[model samples]
Target: MSTPTTVALPTDMELVLKVFPMPKDSNNNGDIFGGWVMAQVDLAGAVLPARYTCGRMATVAVNEFIFKQPVQVGDLLSFYSKVTKIGRTSVQVLVEVFAERRVLGNQYVKVTEATLTYVAIDENGRPRPLPITELQPRRQY
Candidate 1:
């Protein structure tokens, strides 16, 4: 076995969402539930889809997810997302979660990352086509 090299995500990240986890969100073991973090990612990914799709959309799949670090109490979590790929009716977004430790001042670290796929939808909740946009390439992390 070998260690997987972690590549820093692109810096052209768009901050799509943010939220502070409260103490009540803790689990029995006192660690923040992974499910809560996932929900935040979903909400974060949905922001651009709702705008780009010009209507409602739904999460079709989670292509990849990795937890690079843990999130603890008093950490300020920020979710950054960007459109990585677009299709006729689907869009792929990469969401990165960074957490700022309470006692560490401005020091922050990447805590999680996930690739989310969403499908444009119409009022009836049926799949719809995506619109064209000037696609920009994100390079820095």
Candidate 2:
């Protein structure tokens, strides 16, 4: 048998989510659907942006998305995310999804990577400038 591929998880990014795909998430080819992956990416990608967006935000664009490998049922998926840009009223995030095989000694395989943009919104659903004061300074040791 060939050795399974493994990738080092990112230290700079945050572990936003971890999930296991069910059989229902798979397609005819026995791999999970791309839409399902995109939906998860959207959810995972919003994590870092939420800190800056505060009240509410909406996905405005998927700047880039690439599915590196097929995700099978029962694979443990970990979603890592980081903020790439924080604009006046929007935040761009990079989300990378890695899958671990339960039978393959939990070797990690990068399944997907996506860049998404989210715009802060008001109660009326209109775009609103991000609250700059919300980004408080971190304490220095």
Give the best candidate by TM-score. Answer: 2
lDDT of each: 0.79, 0.88
> TM per model?
0.83, 0.90
RMSD of each: 4.5, 3.5
Q: List the residue pairs that clash in candidate 2.
A: none
Give lDDT: candidate 1, residue 76: 80
Candidate 2: regions farther than 4 A off? 1-4, 133-141
Q: Supply the global lDDT for candidate 1.
A: 0.79
lDDT of 2 by residue, 1-141 (tens): 133468999997788999999999999999999999999999999877887888899999999999888899999999998888888999998999999987778789888999999999999999999986254343243
Residue-pair clashes per candidate: 1, 0
